[model samples]
Target: MITRIFPSVRRLHRRWFYGLMAMVMAVGIGLATPKPSQAGLLDLIFNGIQYIQLSNLSTQDEVRLGRRIDAQLKRQGVRIYNRDPQIVAYVDQIGQRLAAASARPDLPYTFQVVQDDSINAFATMGGFVYIHTGLMEEAANEAELAGVLAHEIGHIGGRHAVNQMRQIALAQGVAGALGVDQSALVNIGVQLALSLPNSRADEYDADQRGFRTMGQARYAQSGLVSFMRKLDERSGARPEFLSTHPDPGNRVENLEAMLESEGNPNATDGLNNSAYQSKISSL
Candidate 1:
């Protein structure tokens, strides 16, 4: 054994060891101070995914996204022609009326019609509810359109997108939390939302809102169900709209249940096959 190692020299190693410990403690304290990040790396990633998927967005941002989509339709030469401003006004009137009674009235609800023949109606961010000429043509009457718009409004008023976005943000990474760009999120979120089945929770909420709006506004709640019922029989027989807003064959049943639950006729919709077709034809 090398007793040649003196005790004094050996004690010297202790000083170095103590210094190293102090440095590590300083690093730990610096980390604990929490300057900006409240989440760990994993937390940040999870948040991003949670939010961008369908959850956390402000009303202002939502309206902005809707505006962007409206602009895009214009740039793409999409037809948004409304031959009769009254018809357009009628649609907005219905939308506004129901929106006033929705769960999230703070949303900026706006309704528009696109003169497209795709048999499609979709809801965009903010509160943009779009009914395509094709959708109007297919609907038996205004109540049908009201039902459709009400459902879209439900999507906005329920804050479905906002809640979905929060989940996505949680799943996203640190970079996502460090000021994630919303433009990219909407572009990405739409894709995700399109693929993923709208949660039963959302479907249920929209169902409630749609039926209530129709009933309260004196529109035909049954028309909402009727439109969905015939999707299996229509020429398109289930448009891309289904992918965005899926209903597993219980649409009428759901509406009926809602009506039974509500105990009244909210809206009066008698299907006018010829009238609907004529109005849409002008588009």
Candidate 2:
């Protein structure tokens, strides 16, 4: 009877040991697992659901988003081209003309050139459009520069950034963006400016909008096509503009389509002036 009892007691001990080890391993996995912030899974799920229900942003929200991006730009030490008021004014004048012809003509557009030599340009929320000095130098004439500006203005007019921001908020689970949390705007600004580019669809929409604006503003529709051709020729080793804008060939094709639909208007509607060349050369 003693031996039989001893066997039973050993079996019980072995069972208990195995159970304890299993429990320890479960707890170890729980400790090692990476969690999403302090918000936990439930909060992230709720935030994502709430964001999905949101439709349109208010005008005030758009302004706040722009201000946050402007702040970030300043903090990043991006140099604004201001050495020559004449050159600056010239670029702004061209931008203003395009904006006047854009769908959202009432928006207060602000066009600025950066001192960087890289051939790139971008537009953010609100009416802010930035042109790099290198892009200005690369453009063959005033019309070519206008083509670039109109494309950027098209992005602003179409609220493409707003669409991009909505996507970012959903992916990252910005708890405050769906509510009154203003800090979320700051995060959105940084991500939009530094990381994300507009989707291919968005790029195509901007291309169409710009073509219309150029035609309405009498900027010579060929300006866009010509500029794209030149851009394609020089696009080597991953251009900065290519990161944001589509491939130059695709853009050129789109612009040509617009021209074809419009009965093929003269490509030289806008021409370069001596004053325009002088201003560019001085830089």
Candidate 3:
């Protein structure tokens, strides 16, 4: 009898809840339509739906969303390097180490190398991180490469991509009463990962988080600091990294200060430049 009732309840719950939510969303949109500010109405509706869908998004849901965006990105011509499995595995090993020490360790992190040589790395929600071959070549040591991976993981832990999606949803307005369409959200995410710059606040927050994560993972914090300095020197060329992550004023100085405040403990794990180059020599 219990088994019989459980299946019935499960079926009813899905149908009933989704129908009720859809109806409520529709009514809310209709009532919001006449508000003096169309933009304001849209904002209200989006916020309401976003709160229901994204603010409390389950880990499973977020991961599913990430998979869709990642698939779409591959379809749209993002070349992932498969020429060397060793290089790919090396990155994943470092990324896994950082993710384990990160604030959000439960997430299943994936690290992939892109074939591009433009010196950039990016992460979307659900612990997906990508590093460019160029960025790997630019790093002088293992710690520097680890530093970049930690920073990308930091963005995932902070759910900055979700926040960015919220802003995009607000700006574009919802496409339907149900909310920003899932397919649309995937497209927006691809754009965000590929081209859009994170807010200054997001950049600073990721920096702080990444700095902390690096320390926890026992990588030399100076690696992150030095990498930032390298990017700053290239301010004229404006590397894809700096283009995607707007520099908060005094960023390197701030990181240096953080290192100082922590007493700049001597960490010896990833500072071996020769070892790092040998690991990625195939690239």
The candidate with the higher lDDT, 2 or 3, is 3
lDDT of 3 at 13: 94
Instruction: Give the runs in model 1 whose Cα sits over 4 Å from its true position.
Output: 1-57, 72-78, 82-84, 168-175, 189-197, 235-237, 269-281
TM-score, model 3 to reference: 0.80
**Residue by residue across 99-198, what tens digits does model 1's lDDT show?**
8877767777878877777666766567877787777777777667777888887777776765665566566642243455555565544643334456
Model 3 C-alpha lDDT versus the unseen true structure:
0.86
- Answer with 1 or 3, whichever has the higher TM-score: 3
Please tell me which model should have the higher lDDT, number 1 or number 2: 2
Off by over 4 Å in 2: 1-54, 176-180, 263-268, 273-275
Q: Given candidate 1, what's the lDDT at residue 201? A: 77
lDDT of 2 by residue, 121-239 (tens): 98887788889998888787788888889888888888888777766766776645345244565667666765577788888888888888988888787778788877777735755
Candidate 2's C-alpha lDDT? Answer: 0.77
Model 2 pairs in collision: none
